[model samples]
Target chain A: MYLAKIHITHKASILDPQGEAIKNALHRLDYQDVSNITAGKYFETTLTSDSKEQAEATTRSICESLLANQNMETFLFTVEKVED
Target chain B: MYLAKIHITHKASILDPQGEAIKNALHRLDYQDVSNITAGKYFETTLTSDSKEQAEATTRSICESLLANQNMETFLFTVEKVED
Candidate 1:
């Protein structure tokens, strides 16, 4: 089996309120040095694929169709073998 | 500097609509054998510190105060030395 890890993030030009909120909270928590904490979505999937090409193709299609809003968000994924 | 990688996921018992949508999309993308896609949030923080304890404490405080919603989501993080 293969594991696909995906991340979706808003375009750099977009303002992310969730990220801003987290950044402010980090300061309150004493992490005063942290800045620009952009929050993004992560997804992990188990796939019954044997080849990296197949996994990538499948994951890309998924991202384009439903995993991300292509106009507003962009996504990237990594595929790896599941170790027993 | 240190790198903090944080992942926040909805409690396992909660129904994840985003995850379900991704699962369906994966199948349509020809990954018929894939299942159970869980979606979460990822945060990467660069700390201005040299001590592990300080990093951990700061990250934890950030999570508790703003990075995560304790009632609905839980988080885990890893700290690593950033390579120049």
Candidate 2:
């Protein structure tokens, strides 16, 4: 088995309103040192695969097909071997 | 400056309906090897701080105050120095 850890985040050019709102909220709560915030999604998935390469390919396909919006977001993931 | 990468995830005992939904969707898309999925939130935050320890403390406080719900979610974070 393999465990894939994925992070899907907005592209640098995209404006993240949710992140902006959170930054504003933190400021209101007195975390004045905060400068910038980018909020995104994280996922941990377990896959039964024969090899590391296959596991990675499956993870990338999954991210591209369903987890991320290619127009506005990009995803990065790492697959690691695990005992199952 | 320091960059803090934070992940907020549901506790093991908590039920995650969104994750279940995504798992089912992947199955429908022919990803039969996929077994378990857990979804969470990720944040990349920049803070102006003099030291790594201070940045970490600030990040933890921010997470506790607004980023995470203590009742059901747990958070993990890492702070690193960054060029400003």
Candidate 3:
């Protein structure tokens, strides 16, 4: 088995309301020393496939189809085999 | 400087619509071998604090105040010093 972890985030040039909200809250909570609290989405999937190539392909397909909104967001992923 | 990485996810007993949608999409994309695509939120904060304790305390305060909805979601975080 393999584990595929994916992260999706807004494009650098785009405004991220969720991220901004978090940053504001951090400041209000006396965390003034912290800044730029960017928020994103993370996804984890367990692929029951036998081959790494198969798992990668499957993960890629999923990312393109629904895991991300390619128009406004960018996605990056890592695939690793599950240790017994 | 330090980096605070926070992840927030729905409680196990709660229904995660985003996760379910991603799981279904994976199957539709011919990734039938993949299952349980759970989704969550990830936040990264760069702290300019000089002390680890200060950073930790600030991060905890932010998490409780707004980083997560304590009633429906659980949050876990890791704080690491950044290498120059």
Candidate 4:
């Protein structure tokens, strides 16, 4: 089995209003040292793949087709072997 | 400068409907090998702190007070120094 740890985030050029809101809330709560914040989606996925390369390919395909919006978001993931 | 990479996930016992929906979608898309999936929130936060310990403490506090619900969710984070 393989485990894919994925993170999908907004492109750098896009405005992340949710992240901005969180930063603002932190400031109000006296966490003034927080300089910048960006929010994203995290996924822990387990799949049955024959090899690490196959796992990575499957993960990438899934992200591109479903998990991430190609126009506004970017995704990165690491695929690791796991004992069943 | 310090960077805090945080992940907030639902508790193990919680029913994650969103994750279930994603898994179903993937199955329909012919990713039958996908066995399990969990979704969470990811944050990349930058803060000005003198030490790694301080940064970790601040990040923990932020997760406890704002990012995670103690009853239904849990969080983990790593604090590392970064080039300014």
Evaluated on CA atoms against the true complex, candidate 2 attains a DockQ of 0.94
Q: List, residue by residue over A1-84, the lDDT tens digit for candidate 2.
A: 999999999999999999999999999998988999999999999999888998899999999999999999999999999999
Predicted model with the maximum TM-score: 2
DockQ class, candidate 2: high
DockQ of each: 0.59, 0.94, 0.75, 0.91
How far residue A66's Cα lies from its native spot in candidate 1, in Å, is 2.1
The ten-residue window of minimal lDDT in model 3 chain B covers B22-31
- What Cα-based lDDT does every candidate model obtain? 0.80, 0.96, 0.83, 0.95
Better of 3 and 4 by DockQ: 4
TM-score of chain A of 2: 0.98
Across residues A1-84, which tens digit of lDDT does each residue of candidate 3 receive? 899988888888888898888778667766679867888998888889889998898888788877778888888889999973
Where model 4 places Cα greater than 4 Å from the true spot, the runs are: none
Query: TM-scores across all candidates?
Result: 0.77, 0.99, 0.85, 0.97
Query: Which residue pairs in candidate 1 collide?
Result: none
Ordering by lDDT: 2, 4, 3, 1
Best by lDDT: 2
Candidate 3 error regions (>4 Å): none
Off by over 4 Å in 2: none
Candidate 1 residue-wise lDDT, B58-80, digit = tens: 78878887778898889999987
* Candidate 3 local lDDT, residue B60: 82
* Model 1 Cα lDDT, one tens digit per residue, A1-84: 778899898888888788788777667766775745778888888777668788787778778877788888889899888863
